[model samples]
Target: MKCPLCGCEKAHKHGKTSKGGQRYLCPHCKKTFTDTFDTIYYRRHLNTDEVHSILQSHTEGSSLRGISRITQRAYGTVVSLVRAASQKAQIVHNAKVQKIKTKEVIGNEMWSFVEKNKKPVSQKN
Candidate 1:
């Protein structure tokens, strides 16, 4: 595997981590890392699919406790994962989002009122 820090190939297996993850050593950069290095899964017990499920639940408006119960993980773990995902999303948004001046902006209160109070046509007509 290649080193995450240097992106150098030809790295070889060095040892196993305390958690039994295979570790690779890079000769080019003298850095040691695992398959999950620099990723959200790094040092986390939850796998990628588990992390994805948590994120999906969060997007679906599930509460932290609810997510914990659904995923069979601790409440604190749910919060930590949500926070990490939020931070990562924020970084990506800050990097890729652009600001533009607009003449008018719609507020949430107006949108909610409009959404909940739609008028209906006369049934007889």
Candidate 2:
């Protein structure tokens, strides 16, 4: 694996993270990083399935509080995950939408006009 810090190709197996993920050490920069480095799952305590479940529930119209309650996670954790997911989605959307080519577009607009008839009634004295 390439070193994330110095972009060096000489990286060795440093150790394993607490979660059993492989860790690498870059001899060029003397930096140690895990396999999850620079990834969405980096430094996250929750496992992959839990993170997926949280994101899925958020997309499925579940509120943060609701997801927290259902997942038994802290409210702060749910909020943080939701924010991170939103940012990542925005990044992906920007990247993918920039490559789109548009030709012709069809659209419709509706206009309504309301008129009230005004008639003066003769008053009986």
Candidate 3:
């Protein structure tokens, strides 16, 4: 497998992670990494399905406590999962969407901010 960090093509299976994921050793970087490395699931004990379920529930607008109850995970774990997922999504977005050509772009929140900050106009008698 090609090492993501060093782009080395001569990596080999070094070992298995505690969660039974295959580990690879990068000959060039002299580092060990797993399939989940550089992903939201990296260094996390949760399996692929568990992380998927958490993200699915989060996308469904489930509250943190609700997700914790639904996934049978701790409240903190739910929060961390959402946080990690968002960070990974941001990284993927930045990588994939390199350029955008647009004349003008505005968001709903920006309009609200402008409306809220508008100066008051005095009434004419």
Candidate 4:
């Protein structure tokens, strides 16, 4: 395995995580990291299918509490998952939208001025 911290290919098995994923140790960087390090799923207990279900339910107009009840997850977990997903989507949107080129823009404007006095200025004076 390769060491993620130092980009070294001399990594050895250090231990196993609580979830049974193998942990690697890098001699060069003297650091221990797992295969999931730095990933969105890192440290997350929920599996992919569960998270997908939660997001799908949320997009289908399910409330956080309702999602929690439906998915059998805690309400706080549902809220946090939704918030994290929203943040990720916003970031992706900003990145992709920046690359789009605007071909054309159609617009119009009108300008007008109104006077309180209806009489001609010369006649009023």
Question: In TM-score terms, which candidate is top?
Answer: 3
TM-scores for all candidates: the values are: 0.63, 0.73, 0.74, 0.62
Off by over 4 Å in 3: 103-125
Backbone clashes in model 1 = 0
Q: List the candidate 4 regions with Cα displacement exceeding 4 Å.
A: 1-13, 95-97, 104-125
Q: What's model 2's TM-score?
A: 0.73
Which residue pairs in model 4 clash with each other?
none
**Clashes per prediction?**
0, 0, 0, 0
Distance from true position, residue 90, model 1, in Å? 1.7
Candidate 2: tens digits of C-alpha lDDT, residues 32-124: 999878666788888999999988887777877788999999987887777776667668878886755779867543221113447989899
Question: What is candidate 4's TM-score against the reference?
Answer: 0.62
- Candidate order by lDDT, highest to lowest? 2, 3, 1, 4
**RMSD to truth, every model:** 11.6, 13.0, 8.0, 14.6
Whole-model lDDT per candidate = 0.79, 0.80, 0.80, 0.77
lDDT (Cα, tens digit) per residue for candidate 1, span 1-125 = 87779888889999999988899999999989988886677888998899999888877777677888989999778878777766776688788867957999874321101123468866984
lDDT score for candidate 2 against the true structure: 0.80
